[model samples]
Target: MESPLKNFAEVARKFCAWAETQPVSTENEVKTAIELLANLSSAILATSNLGFGEDLEGERISDEEWRVTYNRFGFLPFNYYSTFFNPANVGKEEPVIGDLADDLADIYRDLKAGFWLYDRGHVKEAVWEWRQSFQTHWGRHATGALYALHAWSTNESIQL
Candidate 1:
């Protein structure tokens, strides 16, 4: 039996691969990808609070590579309303456009980092890194991406 961490890692890996290669030519394709991401995000958060530890060696893909893959989804129009990252003090929600390709890439970048560590056999580091980043960062992007994808699929006639 696979460990929970490995199971989650596999899901992350598969999602990344699928996202990168999946067809976006039709609404059905996009909806399927969105569903995969939403489920992945939920599963990630479910186990995020279950551990604590130091991270091991890990690496990130080149920014160029990230942007390149991000560009592949350029054909997609991933638009959503974004809140100001630091609006609590202002007490005003400044709305902005959130791009799904960019946001999805952001989430995938973090997941790839975790995947890197796990692939290299640093299991503890992978889980720690994933949990910490999920809590601190990519979780927002993942959720936002899901929302944008869903809204796009359900209401293609409307842009949010």
Candidate 2:
């Protein structure tokens, strides 16, 4: 089996490339979005399968970097949105503008932090940080983005 860290890093790289190059309103927008969502989802599963060694915090930015910019309508024709699911409001809906750029950017930012540590020979820190952020942050973004992309692909409403 491939190392989870490597798999995650590769996914991050591919996502970055896609975000940077994917044009607006492509003919196969749905297909591209589906593929991107699949990669992000796989990275999340890989994170879950990996162990949380050392339980240490990796380097984090006090202020996050700028949001990743991308072709807004490149992945989907319409703007997408979703919100955190609360058990108390299981049936209620709160929709925000959930663009693909923001979704990919969230995943990229967390992945970059871990990859930075890994590149600097802090392997343990990298894995620990990646897995931790996966649970607390990026994982939710991936899932939400998946919901949006899948809905777009199927011509259905974005259901959270």
Candidate 3:
């Protein structure tokens, strides 16, 4: 059987490829995004805790590049949603605005970093990159984006 890390890499690749297509906010695109995000989220969890590997430097994706990715999803029906910085502090704290585009872009950027290492025959490093980033970063974006996308999908009143 293939390793869980490999499985996650596959899912990440699929989601990244779809994002690279610069999907619009058409009904089909929305559906696809929802499904892919869900799949990616689940796949990420399956990797659980991975062992650390050699630390390798990778090229950083510039903010301008990220902005281009964000702009691609301009056709989305909604971009902003209200969420708490910490859900546990819900009643005590004010909700902050979360941007779906930002969530997607961050997820893409994090996964791509792991993909860079994995593609270069550094499986352990790639797994470490993914697991670490997931725990510290992309995991939050994935959940927030999933929640937002779920809201968008279930509401029939919101047109694509």
User: Any runs in candidate 2 off by more than 4 Å, and if so which?
Assistant: 22-29, 47-65, 68-76, 82-84, 92-99, 156-160
Q: Which of the predicted structures, 2 or 3, would earn the higher TM-score when compared with the native? A: 3
Worst lDDT window (10 residues) for model 3?
A: 50-59
Candidate 1 on 32-75: residue-level lDDT in tens?
Answer: 55777777776776664445555364688789978976876665
Which residue pairs in candidate 3 have backbone atoms (N, alpha carbon, C) closer than 3 angstroms, thus clashing?
A: none
**Overall lDDT per candidate, in order of appearance:** 0.72, 0.64, 0.79
lDDT of 3: 0.79
Cα-based TM-score, every candidate = 0.80, 0.69, 0.89
Better lDDT candidate (2, 3): 3
lDDT of 3 by residue, 1-160 (tens): 9777777878888888877885654777777777778888788788856577677844457789888878877667789998887998758998899988898888888888887888888877787888888889888888887788778778855453
Q: Between the candidate structures 1 and 2, which one is better when assessed by TM-score?
A: 1
For model 3, the stretches where C-alpha displacement exceeds 4 angstroms are 157-160
Winning model by TM-score: 3
